[model samples]
Target: MTQHFTAPDRLTAKTGTQWWRDAVIYQVYPRSFADGNGDGMGDLEGVRARLPYLRDLGVDAVWLSPFYASPQADAGYDVADYRAIDPMFGTLHDADALIRDAHELGLRIIVDLVPNHSSDQHEWFKRALAEGPGSPLRARYHFRPGKGESGELPPNDWESIFGGPAWTRTADGQWYLHLFAPEQPDLNWDHPAVADEFRSILRFWLDMGVDGFRIDVAHGLVKAAGLPDIGGHDQLKLLGADVMPFFDQDGVHAIYRSWRTILDEYDGERIAVAEAWTPTVERTANYVRPDELHQAFNFQYLGAPWDAAALREVIDVSLAAMRPVGAPATWVLSNHDVTRHATRFANPSGLGTQLRTPGDRELGLRRARAATLLMLALPGSAYVYQGEELGLPDVTDLPDEVRQDPSFFRAAGQDGFRDGCRVPIPWTVEGSSYGFGSGGSWLPQPESWGKLSVEAQSGDPDSTLELYRRAIAARRAHPGLGAGSDVRWLDAPEGVLAFARDGFVCTVNLTGRLVSLPLPGRALLASGPFTVDGDRFELPGDTTVWWTV
Candidate 1:
């Protein structure tokens, strides 16, 4: 065992608050980010090698997806251990090197914290199973009896997110519940010991000089009362439980407040970015109100229909919902879970209905640029996915054999969930392995990315990468986006979503035809042709433009 870092004596201003909020975050899936030992798996050392590329992107931080010890179920969400690094991702020494190098490159590092559950392989869970009812360790987790004394049925009728019964029969004849995959058991947030253990985990990482956490599934902390199966389930019941009460338990905030106190003592402002599924504005906003999370993801923009009217309605709803609680919303268009925006907005689905040959790819460059301006120019923190800035198209046609997500396995293609978005990123145009490495990758790189590497587009002035750079730079120039300022939507019609921040009026054209837009003020920047005198502008297929009124 080697220790690269014992503990930091002090953490200082060289790594400050601005390191996170104002920063652009590049998310790296450890198995797909980079391969260090040439074992065909991306590792911590691999990411350490690529720190400079992230710095070049003008981002302030990098959110490395979960690399903690896990059984690799759900790609490392099922944590077997909180303190040690997974051998597949590399050793703890590698993680220390990663933190040092990332900081040296002026990039703050925030790792994922899956506090919701742990791998069933964890030693503690094993101990609890070995010594059942009387074992003091049993108190560390939730314990409940089967529906009958004979234990013939589950205690409740609930379904797992992975698409099956939530409860599994222990070989010893008791029932333990799991909300997701059977191998990933839910943590008993109600247990005092569980809270104590998690608080200790906060100290372990903060003491290690790590920046902060992106808390995974913030809503899954607590469990429903009675440990009852899904609602009204006397028989074989399936699907989401009445876990909402226990799940974001008031006790969870107690743990967060303790962590907050510790961060203050160290003079470190550690942010907890929550991954929540709460759809309504007020519910999501409650998670980030001042003392709670610094930011929670606002996903309304991600699923918004590609229409000016639809997007504007979402923006209005988000602002009204998030502002009351002083919770700053994150406007994300794409992530590891959703289809790439270039696939959704850039490619007009209706156009395919008319013509056999799709014109979406050719116009994707302009529409993507328009989407960029719409996202960055808005009055919130904008999140860009790994390849989204480079206009990486989704691998819509991935063969069924290559899809690796368990969601697909569970639903068997019911929801058409997330298969295309999880493909490997392309780093070069031509190679046996998409320049990801000398050998093959853990997942196949999307062939559509052959012409979309950061290396290829970074140098070209007219590239989507360049346009993303400009949009980010423009946001930095305007202080209101990072900080809070009132946002007002301008009177723009369908296919054109327009808004004014302070006095800067930004408009986007989501239509295919070259519709002339009214230039309300001056044309500071124009990606497509439009008219004068009025704010009306022609938004050609997939094009966007911005200006000040």
Candidate 2:
């Protein structure tokens, strides 16, 4: 039996005036985005060279993962020097040039900032270690004495998000807290010096002409007073669903409020984005409360199942949460830490973000394309991860010996298989590394990726790359898209979702069979082929269509 959905009335118009509110930001993972020096590793120069690609793709900004001076222990998250660029990624001059070039291309550059931890090799940590116990330098971090009589046990029962104990004992018998790897020690946010140093670091980057910062682990900067124990095992699974003493603490908001002050001092609309994983969308909203950050990543939307009801519910809650605070909701499907959405939607629900089994590739790509259209029709800013526009799926066949994710080495830890999503993207149809670099990529590219390369898809109107280009162009030209704060739900049958914004309507079919729906307006775009009969349109399964009334 065919289901049908009737059109609904249009809603009052609500617009987003600020650039960040309705911006389309592209995330460039520097390690795999492109390699310009033939060093097999992506560098700042590579990003500069690719600035035009981004501008032509229609994204308003680029959010780059860290390229700071690091030990490469956690892919640049463990910063050895916040003020310097890693030699592997190029010099400080390269960063300045990239930022300048990006600005000249009419794009903003947002660099990653790791405030929760610093590399053990950082000068401050080195000095703290040499100063021994009770040194003022040690006060800058969470250094505490062990609990057992012999001081052999860790201070508390807390567990690292990456697995194992959260505390690592030092040579002097004192223990330090690290929610991630032992080489990345947590900073004591309560210390005035810690706060002051971060403020200075913020200024240093702003002075470098970078647009803003995408704060890493933004919710973990402050721990509850007394560093209370969570008293539970397998705590990694509870993250973003339950509150712990170590994360989403109220004190973190004060830190962001201070950072916001620094951001406002600049000429441009410099912003701070929180990569916060809180228990609820409402709790996530707190991170962007007027005086705090400008946006928080919408994980609720990203993690929702492919079911229409589930997606609609997530959208409703997300928009409601961000409304009172006057912050635009941010939508993202995939990132460095999670499996690609194409692969995710291809499989069944409850498979988690790190997939060990490859699902139906064709099904996944179809759903992913439909999902992209639906996301673009939504009211807030959207983030497109590098390679997602190419319809790239996670590389699930990497050998164990080639894995570099720290979580992969941990037992029973947070899904450590993030390496599958970090594989280098293909640029050309043929080459040692598919034209990623002359020296080959740091991570090997799959032979299958050649068919999906930019060179292969550039001119094909049916390619995912072309679909993205057209959708982004339509969003820019259509006044109804990317402006409103809410969606008006229309009458949709089960397994289908339909909504209307100002002068625009979007309908998605999530069922396995074709469904008939009233033709509310002229079709503007579609994820797949469809048929129209008189005033009704036949929407194919696993498809989305955008319409203009």
Kindly report which residue stretches of model 1 are placed more than 4 angstroms away from their true locations once superposed. 1-21, 229-251, 346-366, 411-419, 521-537
RMSD of 2: 7.1
RMSD to the native, candidate 1?
4.7
Candidate 2 per-residue C-alpha lDDT over 1-549 given as tens digits, one digit per residue, 9 for 90 to 100: 111112111100111236788888899999898888999998888888888888888888899999999999999999999999999999999998888777767788899999999999999999999999988989999999999888999999998888889999999999999999999999999999999999999999988877789999999999999998877556887899988899999999999999999888876678899999999999999999999999999999999999988998999999999999999999999999999999999999878788987799999999999999999999989999999999999998888989999988987677788988899888899986887888988887788999999899998999999999999989988999997699999999899999998899999999968999999899999998999999999999999999999
The TM-score, computed over Cα atoms with residue i paired to residue i, of candidate 2 is 0.96
State model 2's lDDT: 0.90
Task: Give each prediction's root-mean-square deviation over alpha carbons.
Answer: 4.7, 7.1
Question: 1-549, model 1: which lDDT tens digit per residue?
Answer: 112332232224424534344455667777776676777777888789878877666666678888888888777888899999999989888998888877666666778888887888888888988997667765666555677759778777666666667777776767777777778877787687888888788778766667778888787776656654334543212111222433544456665666566555543466778787653666677777666777777766666666777778878888787788776657787777667766665555443111112236756556666777777766656677777778876666666787666667774222444656666666777874566666677666755667887668878887777777766766666644454635776676567777776657777776666666566666655554555645444556556666755
